[model samples]
Target: MISQAITPRELDRRREQLVDLQRYLADQEREYAELRRRVQGFIDRYVATLGPLYMELDALESQLYCAMRYLHEALARNGLDTRGPDSPKATAMPQLLVLPAGAPLPPEPEGGLIQVGPPPLKTLYRRAAKRLHPDLAPDDAERGRRERKMAEVNEAYATSDRARLESLLLAAGESMVKVRGGDADAVMEWLRSTERAVQGRLRVVQAHIALLTNHQMHALGESVERAEKKGLDPLGIMANRLRAQITERRQELYIGQRLQPESSLTEAFLRQREQRLGGGLSAARAP
Candidate 1:
């Protein structure tokens, strides 16, 4: 019974990760478009005479190509389709899914798409804690106990357990508000907070892994060496490298926040002027 209760919560967590991955891809696409617009300005003003501008343009194009590839790979990893004929280029591109012409895109799923809903174990814990906490206690020892129970309330809330949130506010303490109605702002706030907390925990775990200098890492390295000695295939190494590249691109998409352009074409033309004259025009013009 305990395992059955726990399974769906784990699935919900997995779904949240995929949603973040999608957001990351979208941001990458926006940034790529901005870069292209900027480079197009240089292309217009210099008309291919600006060597440095050409190089910058090439780099931006390459970045877009790589970003698209990363988006495609991420979609495949999540068992989502990368190829939607309507947005052929966007298939592998991050930040926008291509829908067939005249067809409206599907709305982002509510809460998320991975699990049934919030975990049931969380409410059970919150109820138990609320009954014991010092703040809601019938006496002094009970109050001290309640203070400690506050930590449990926080943990449950952190997991986006709606039932637990309601239970914490309702059990004994009095000033309770029912959370029956779903608020968009409240959901978004919780989602962002959860994302930050998870990322923080992941960083800590990664640091610990890095610090395991001579023990686990060295042992793993020695095992890999032994395997290579027994004849590891060159193709496997190449495949691993490709996987690494795709992962790095996904990470970039996550960290790099993208802003939509207000005046894309104008910005492009301005960039071209700036490129022709090293960011500003000279007062002395040669005829």
Candidate 2:
């Protein structure tokens, strides 16, 4: 069996391939960030505009359902409804949709084990602290900036986040790799581990991007954006439409409330809602 020889040429090729993957990963992550920002912004605006109206509409529906249910029971007490047992016991509570959370920006790993120098994580943390510590700042303004960064460094150190420490060090213009010399097999192992970590992050970025793209809200937001480009107020238009529905539902609730327990409209109203609300609200018969 021939022992696999790690050559300089082979190492260079691996470095180049890893660089390409890292570049692609960075681009994907950037795109994901921007996409999340836009989609979340759209959702926020939409809810701000239309959310109250929807709540009002649902409340009106609930009142109508309750009114109808009371009348239905009244009819049953009077032996009016021949339509037997199949009313929805109660209204189904609607579930709300929550936005997908942002994916964490993982750092690319960089370090050296030149004859096993001090523990890498501690070394990286010290490097980050030295660079980011607020006391090193020459001015109050710079000190404030450094303070925030220093907090991050402290947090990274407390949690033993090697990659985070390395990232902080890199951001402060500190070099992460400090190899005066190292074994070929060790270098190969480091390279493979880094590649695997990067590849795993790439998958996370891709999946998050897919999740944002495929969300129903994304398409709605796109439509709203396009409408805005054309000088159309799609959200405003939707708000107006909802207001109209609210006014109409209010009138319907008034009528339902005014409806005599034996009025023929009670039966018709229940029939109409049976299909709309899965007919579980109540079954009623009129005189």
Candidate 3:
């Protein structure tokens, strides 16, 4: 809403602040893009190297759990499910399902989209240079200010910082004689709205940058890089651990398969295993 008219100095200050925020927002976007590329690179490599191994491990786990369930049901048949009939039933156990090897795992869900508004205005520096070239200055004092401001615009243009050039143009325009019968208030309102839009976009970029920094992929990438710097092979180490686990699971399955479910030893083994696996049956299925 329109209110008291603002002094030129106050208006220039606000425009300068808006331009600074716009430049910062641009930097944040670049940082986020670079970070995403780095994190995704790590994830792509990790999935390619470990995806199949994980699937195989999961399959073995499913089979092992299914065997345990079978043995438990067998015990129930013989009235050995628990100490008494009042104990929890076998139906209370989680259901473990085996998935096909070719199934693809779903990616981690993301939050709302990043809402960056219109692109930066370009070629404004040339216009600013033509208008505020300092040669057009009427006196030494004004010429010096014009030269300094023109230098700033040149630097902004070189770096593709359009906001800086635009603000300098508006600031320069503010010092000129008023145009006849013009709507300065409406023009000022438009600039204020533009500032608000840019501020909103800056906030969105900042939030997204924070999100990317906090993501698990970023942590994983850091750890892997740190390992490499130390001359260690983290990926190989992970693969070795998984291989070791696969070997243990295979041994357990082998012993379980050979033992008769009716035997006392089989009952003891199943009871001990009951302590190990915990979580939804759905947890057993993943890429």
Candidate 4:
């Protein structure tokens, strides 16, 4: 059923594509890691210069966003969807854990709700693990293959990535069939299945690269790079922006405290809300 001339050419092409994709993915990952390091370094240096107010302001901004999110969710739960039809879905805000200058960064999130993947994902992982456990392999080569596949399986399960789990299953099944089958029909089946599995993985890797390159943070990094090219201090620019925000927030808090004696809590809250809204509208309208 399979043509011999086309099979070798197709296989070689696929192999080249896979290698290229893998290398590009590796490069993208390295670039992203470097960007994160630069950003973190800038933040650490800038925050150290600002003393405790910068950290306090950062915490206040986080709390305000969380409060807004909670309010929106509560309203939706009560069937009061205030969001317009064209409004984009709310993205979960990033929460930075600001510690003292010498304090260690917090551990990664794990266990409890964070560790709970979907039931079907867990079931798939168990099935794949049972079949592909490296301990069950009879030879070193097969064991190595199993080890790599098992790592992928574990990662997919941990992330609750159903598509990746299914693709791995399909790839594993194809590999098993390719090893056991010898007839023409079986060879064709193996070729087709293997191609599909590779293509599926290619799509996933391509999408991941796209996401990394198109991320807002990555764009910000690009802007910083451009500013540096023009001999501008990008870090200083960012620090100035942060300093302005902190000053404004501190002024608002000071105003609130001054009004506290003359106004009730609800009245004070309303005044703060009005000030924020007016400030936002004015900023939006400014050239």
Candidate 5:
């Protein structure tokens, strides 16, 4: 249930609440942007120092994994009996299943891909564009001002930035308000709609803030801060860890190179093939 009539005091309170929520949401958004910027700065610095080796390692690992999977599938398709006496199941296998380095990897088995925006954001953008399109302005000067605002709107929509779109819509709405001339019922209706929009935008902003604060990169940044407090270089530590893995992998590959193909290559191929097939079966069986 909702009230149809509104007192002056209630309208004022709603106006103040809307303003406060907008300000708080803006501050939160700025804080999130700053945090993201700092995280990216750290990543850029780290990459500048170790990017080539890191990329090479990643490529090598991916190539190896793909080749192994391909060989396994080929063998199974050919009806090869892998459970024979000389199979990998009867031999000692080396630790070839190395885990990925600390850096984030792209999600696997990618399928669904789409561009999506919140319904509220899209509605606000449509409404704002209806009211603020530069071509609709009466005078050249006003048109110029609207042209600039329209640019902002276009950029916000391009990025699917909900906060920026909401702010632009609020600003445009406020500018159209005539404090002295409107009918009371019309003004009240406008107030109700504005209140709903503001409250809806505030919820979106708060959810975005929550997501940013709890993001993996944000958590990593906090970890780095904690490490700095103890006089440790967290980025350097990560670099050293990756370097150590690279050295170990190089050594393993070197040893594999020296062995006969029938020995190391066959063993590695069989082992990886078994693991792949077994994993597929296990996943199929999962509840």
Candidate 6:
């Protein structure tokens, strides 16, 4: 079985194929991250705009049901079959009552009991990478498309937005967390580490951009008033601007502030975010 080895040309070709596959894999990873970012942004935007409507709708529906029940009870006492045989009440009656139009609805459960699926580490990584794998691309134009997709995924993963990450994990059917022997500390540590590794650098870049914008706005006090009307804190913006200015002189100042014994960057960001969003967002500490 000691046959001669393959020719140099064949060996070279094999190497090239391997290289191509490696490049493709890298591209896939980047694409995955970008997809995650887009998903997170969409979720954020949706929650921002329609979360209230959902809350309102829930409340209204609850009130409507309760009122209808009271009304039904009253009618039953008075022996009125207002509900037709086709009505849902005909099968199993619920108490019915009525209230004025546009009246505030009774409170309902804020949200349903959510059933979280397993975490997805592998599936997301693969799907994301596949979407932008250069090997899968047939031509230069297609390769370029992959590159762009890869860039977005990279950026999104860099932000470490876990809500979107979880969504991606669900879609991909992978778990970031292991279930065999649950070590709470280890799991939390990994989560924290992953978040910081992904989100920290991008957040710093975003902060820089925000600082520049704030500085410009401070120069025009009129914009400050507009921000106030939008429920923004002028003083806090001013403070951030001041911090930015100081950080310019000492680049580590921001890092130091975030690394304080009491606060992590994620926690600080959430606190600031809550102040901006009327304290409606979930709270989590960053690494």
lDDT string, candidate 4, 60-164, tens digits: 555444444444344445454432112223333222232212222222222211112223556677778887999999999999999999999999888988778
Position 262, candidate 2: lDDT: 70
> TM-score of each candidate?
0.21, 0.61, 0.57, 0.40, 0.49, 0.26
Q: Residue 58, candidate 3: how far off, in angstroms?
A: 1.3
Clashing pairs in 3: none
Instruction: List lDDT for all candidates, in order.
Output: 0.44, 0.71, 0.62, 0.53, 0.55, 0.42
TM-score of candidate 1 relative to the true fold: 0.21
**Candidate 6, residues 107-133: lDDT per residue as tens digits?**
222211111223344444455666556
lDDT per residue, candidate 5, 126-151, as tens digits?
77788789989999999999999989
Candidate 6 displacement at residue 281 in angstroms: 41
Q: Tell me, by lDDT, which candidate is best.
A: 2
Candidate 3 on 1-287: residue-level lDDT in tens?
Answer: 11257555555676577668778867877886787777778877777766667777877777776776676667667656432111222212111122112222222112111111222345355557777899999999989998999889889888877656667766767321121112335445655766677667667766767877787777877999999999998988888887898898899889887787679797667655654543211111112
Q: For model 6, what is the error of residue 142's alpha carbon versus the real structure, in angstroms, after optimal superposition? A: 63
lDDT (0-100) at residue 162 of candidate 4? 75
State how far residue 105 of model 6 sits from its true place (Å).
56
**Candidate 4 or 5, higher TM-score?**
5
Best by TM-score: 2
Q: How far is candidate 5 from the true structure (C-alpha RMSD, Å)?
A: 19.7
